[model samples]
Every structure is written in structure tokens, then in C-alpha cells.
Target chain A: MTPMTLADAANLHTFVDALRFIGDHPGFLAQKALEQLELSGAALGIAIAVALPLGVVLGHFHRGSGVAIGASIVGRALPSLVLIAAFLTLLGIGFVNNMVALAVLGSGPILTNSYDGVDRVDNEIAESARGMGMTGWQIVRRIELPLAIPLLFTGIRIAAVTIVATAPIAAIAGGGGLGDVIVNQASYRLSGVLGASLCVMALSALVFVALAGIQIGVTPRGLRGTTVVHDHSRKEQQ
Target chain B: MQSHWGDTLQPALVQHIELTAIAVVLGFAIAFPLALLAHRYRKLEHPIGVFSALLYTIPSLALFQLLIPFTGLTWTTVEVALVAYTLVILFPNIVAGLHSAPDEVLEAARGMGLTRMQTLTQVELPLAIPAIVGGLRVAVVSTVAIATIAAFLLPDGLGYPIVLALKEPTPFKTEIYSAGALAISFALLCDLALVALRRALAPWAARGLA
Candidate 1:
């Protein structure tokens, strides 16, 4: 399809028309949104399951920091469209292909943040925990994990937003979502495209806000003040 | 198709670079002054930071489409969104870099009768190069990756082939792999170049003493 001129687009459908299109297809839009949420949620679940343990272990042992941080850099640098295309070739079109690709994409931040969060816990604090004769597992579980909640959630927030944003590409691989509307511009036309984009932006914002709330809720009040100290130390380390 | 792969990819590669370059340059052009302004006025810092972060949170695909009604499917639409993406990274880094020059250094510049502009130009900016270039590297690398999506609107980048292959009746493995590989390599290359730039721009920073 040729690109439309502004006048052509405006004449065809204004943003209001996009909203009306959305309103007209409530069930269809809801299904698309749910598909989007399911795919991203599943991918995020897999990523956290895999990355959290690995990152925390590495961080607890103070090992593989490079791998943790490096993975995130590469992950962030990856283009999601290309990722979906590449996966489609490997796995063929379907939900699995997109799910796996999204999982890999989401894992990076979670891994990096998990490791950094644990690794950055004050040495003196960890030492005191050790001095008190707490087991390694106990220290990691009771001390480091709680302290790392904020950064862990930061990682998750980044991953969730990224996954939600990129989930639209899954439609290209026949994994249905809002992308079905956004990418199928020929069938759905510009109104559906704009409407779906609005849905996606809303979904992403919702995910971010939800994660932020979880981060705050999970963060210990006492440690909240100390995060600043951690921030300062991080700057000094840099 | 095999014989013409080079011809097809060359223009796409050029377009990809052109888009990434323009966006990063324009993003920096806009962000640098905003960073300076935020630095000059403490009150502006929170708002500028919050606004940029909010922009960053908006998905690139959505942002592009959101602009299309007004901007059409032109490169301007893509550039505007891409520039917006860069601000979150660029503004914070530039502000942090500007603050990196210590109070002692600022006082030294002042004590030496250096004017505000002279102090900024000669001392602070020079000191800020590491942080500034660090942020620039991230912005460039991300822009390289994100510009591929612009091909959805404009058939002018590596993303074009990937999009084409995906939309094909039978997906084209060759196109998908080639374009994906090229984009990943391009991002890595840009990152390396920026790392080298940071070294050259602030040689002392490479020494790890600073």
C-alpha cells in the first residue's frame, strides 16, 4: 500500500474515528487486549522464573556480573521486529515462536537488575549478617532479597513494558494480539491501526504503573531511605 | 534473488544508517540545550526529567502511529518519535555529566578568573565527555535498533526486508536472517565506535583513575 498523505488520512479517519472504531468493536478489541496481556504476561513469567534465580545466585556469589550486565545490553540493543522474524524462521509461525523471542528479550533486564540489586547491598551489612552466623542461603533469602526488591522490580518494570510494547509484533508471526489490528492495516485500515496503537500505549503505561506500585509496596520502609545511600555508592563506584 | 542480495541490502543499510544518524543528532541537538537549561535552573530538572521519562515509556510503534494522522507516513513522523526516545537517555546523561565536574574543579576555574562560559567550555564539558559520550553510545545503539521499525512506515531500512519476509506467503529465511544479522551487527559496531569515541574524547577517562 502506498503511503497516505495527511489530507488523505484526515479525510479518511480522524483520531475520533479511531476511538469510535474501538468502541464499535468492543469484543474484538477486548480479545486483542487479552491476547496481548497473555502473551506478554507469560513471557514475563518465564523470564522472571529463569532470570531471577540465576541472577540472584550470581549476585549472591558475586560471580558473572559481566554476563548479567552484558546480556541486558545486548537484549536492549536487539530490534524486536527482527527478533520476531528470526524466530519465525526457526520455529515457524505460531505463539511459541513469539513467546520464546519475547522471553529472551525480557530476561535481559531482569537478569541485570537482579544481579545488581543483590550485588550492591552494603558490604558491611552483609558482613554483619555473616557475623551473626546466618547461613549463606538465609542471608540471601532474608537480607539480600528484601533489599534488592526495588531494583528487582525496576528490572521487571523494564521487562514488562518492553514485552508489552513489542507484543504487537507477535501478530506478524500469527500470534494474535493488538498487532492483528495494528499490523493488518490493509484489512483494518488506518482507524484500526490508530485505535490499536492507543490500546498498546495504554497497556504499556498500565504495566509500568502497576509494576511501580508493586515495587513501592514490596520495598521495606527502612531500606527505602537507604536506597539513596546505595545510589550514592553506585555513583561513586561508577 | 541471491545474485541481487547485495543491491537490495546496500540501499537498505544506507537508509538505516541515515535514519539512525539523523535521529541521534537531532535528539542530541534538542536534548543538549534542555540538559543545560535543567542544569542552570534546579527547578526545571524534575519536570524535564519526568517528561522525558514519560516519553520514553511510550512504545515506539504506538508513538509512530500516534503521529501519523498529523505527520502522515513521512520520515518526519519516525524522526520525531525516535528523537523523543533518545531524550530520556540523553537528557539524564548530559545533566549528570554536567554535574560530574566537582565543586573543587568549578572553584578552581572561577579562582583562575575563568568566565562561566569558559569554565563550562574548558573544564566542565571536557570533564563531562565521558558521561556524555557514554549516553551518546547508548542513544546511538538503541536508535540503530529502533530505526528498523521505521521500515514499517517507510521501506527504507534493514527492517524493510524483514517486514517483507514476514508478510510473504512463505516467510523468507534468507531475508530474515540477513536483515536481522545486519541490524545486530550494526548496533554492536555503533557501540564499539562510541566506546572508541569516549576514549578519544576523554583520554584520561580511559585510564580509569577519574
Candidate 2:
């Protein structure tokens, strides 16, 4: 084995120290994790409430594909740091302000995916449903929605992971989460920063995995392996 | 307004572009080979995709903080995270693009007496340009947006002005709006450039689509 350098030893010490910090501050970490979940969960709820209906309606009509895609492009480009700062003048600081900005941040994928999901359902299927005397809403409710669930849930998963990951930025905006420990490294030290980062990472992964399970569970049995989840519109979630 | 543009916005824009460009290029350099490797070896594809996706699921801020212990608060930490972000976006697109080259086309290239290297370099890669560029556009735009977070570590990029403005007793509205607008515009501009580049690179493909 190669001899370890002083830097390597220091790095090892830092890692162990961070682990110790996490072990010692379970309550603090849990509280921050809860804050993160609540903030992200609220934001995601808002995003789904606003974007899903609009997407579904537009997609049902096969109109406003431009609007859906455009939202995603703009959303992907909008920096959370800048967005929270810009909203500072209007919304002021705190959980509501950050929650609103994060909702806006999370809305894009939900809108785009929901639209793509409904719109991409087979024309034949829709027409056949129409032939069977199904109304527009009925077709949407019964056929289109069932078919669209897989992709729509994929959008929510993307948004959930993104919101969870981004929830930390709320700390910078005075909306406390795990980021409080992360940004206050002067007080918490490097160990705390690293520990908080680990917590945040774990929290995001938990959100992602949980949502993925929910997605799998909710997807129509017929659509499980058939839906093409990857496409150009679905890019980097982070 | 003029003074702010001269003293702050201009420098911030340059730094943002530089930071974004470096991260995307570095990401491509690392991801391209890995994508090619994964494409050639089918067994590696799932693992590589999962690994990159795992990196991407971590929020940008947390990723930067995670690197603080190892790399300190330098731009390297930011770059590493930014590059990692691009991998998840780039790898799948490149691998998909590679697989997109039809077997008929490969057979034709082989029939023309082209070596495996020649077939890949001359035939397959040219066809993959559109998909590769599509990935680049996403990576570049996302990187441009995420690179702003580098300001939390260093006083550079458009994020610097936003952070600075936030630090004020009353946030500087002009600074925040200007920086935010610049970052969005920069991302859009890069995206438009990539679209134009794709059209230029694969005119035949564009024509086919048209």
C-alpha cells in the first residue's frame, strides 16, 4: 500500500469528524430534515395543483404544447438563488417567499410532462373512446389520465427531487432547513458543513426513492415497461 | 444603471460564461468517453447512468458544500459539481445517439471497406451529432444556471451580485433583477446557439425532419 500523505490523513480526520457531528446532532439533523421536507412538499403541492390541470386541459385539446415546453426551458434556466433574491423585494424573506419561488422552480417539469403525457396518448385510443360515446372529460378522466399517469408521475418525481435538493437554498433566504448548518460553517465548522451536506444528500435521495416507489405503484399495469420516460424535453432535473 | 453595468454586470457576465463553458467542456470530456465506453459495453450502461443520476439528484448547493472539505471553497468545488450535473444529462443522450445509428448504415460503412475506427469516426459520430448537441444544449443551459451558485463559495459570476444584493439591509432590486435577467438571457442565448449549431452540423438530418 502507498504511504498516506499528511493531506490524506487530514481529509480522513475531517470525514470522521463530520460523521461524529452527524451522530451527535441527530435531533438537529432531523428537525432540519423535516423543515426541508415540509418546504419542498408544500412547494411540490402548489406546483402540482397549478400546473397539472393546465397541462392536462391543454394536452387534452392538443393545444399549447408551445406553452408547456417554453415553461420548462425558462424554468430550467431560472436560477433558484437569483429567483429567491428577486422575489425578496416582492415576497420579502421567509418560508412563504422561498416556498413560492421553489414552486415556480418545480412547476416546469410538471407542466411539460403532464402535457406530454396526455398529448402523446394514442390518437386511436382517444378516437375509439370517442366512438364509444365518451365525452371529452370522460375520455380524459378514464382513458387519457390512466395512460398519462406514468409520465405525469415521472414529472412529479423530477420536481420532488429538484425541490428537495433545492430546499436548502431556503436557508440563505432565511427559510431554515438543513442549509442553516451548511451556510453557517463559521459557527458549525467544516464538520458541520459536511455533515449537513450529507444530510441534504440523504434527504434528496429519500425523496427521489420514495417518489419513484409511488410512481411505480400508481402507474397503470399495462403502461409499466412500455412508456418511454426519457426524451429531449426531460433533461437535467437538478 | 450605466455604472452598475460597467462595474458589476459586465464582469459578472464574463465570469458566468467562463465558468459555464469550463464546466460543460470538462463535463463533456469526462462524460463522452464514459458514454462511449458504456455504449460499447452494454453491461456498463445501467451502472454508469445510475451513478451519474445519483450525482445529479444531489442539489447544487449541497454538492458544493460536500466538496468544501476536500477542495476548500475554490472554484474547483463548483466546477466538480457543475461537471457532475452535466454527466447525467450528457451520458444518456450520447449513448442513445450512438445506438441511434442504424445497423443498415453501419453495414453500408463496413461494405465500403471502412475500418471500425473509420466507421465510427466518419459515419456513426457524424450521425450522432444532433443528439450529442441536444445533450450539450441542456448541459450548457443548466450549467449556466447552476454556475451562479458558485458565488456562495467565491465572489464571481452573476450569482455574486444577487448574493451581494441579498446581504443589504434592503435588497438591491436593480442588482438582483439585472443579474437574474442576465443569467436567463445567457442560458437562452447558449440554447439558441446550440440549435443553430445542430442545424449546421447535420443539415441532411434537419432537412429530413423538415
Top lDDT model: 2
Judged by DockQ cut-offs, the docking class of candidate 1 is medium
Error of 2 at B46 (Å): 0.8
DockQ of every predicted complex: 0.56, 0.66
Give per-residue CA lDDT, model 1, range B69-141, as digits (tens): 8788899999998888888889999999998988998999999999999998999899989989888978988
Model 2, A111-144: lDDT tens digits are 9999999987777788899999999999999999
Task: Give stretches of model 2 more than 4 Å off.
Answer: A228-238, B206-210
lDDT of 1 by residue, A1-238 (tens): 9787768757566788899988999899989999999999899999999999999999998889679868877986789988888888888888888999999999999999899899878777788999999999999999999989888888999988889988987887887999888878889988899999988888888888788888788788986645623533544564
Question: After aligning candidate 1 to the native by TM-score, how far in Å is the CA of B83 from where it should be?
Answer: 1.3
Question: For model 2, which pairs clash?
Answer: none
Error of 1 at A191 (Å): 1.3
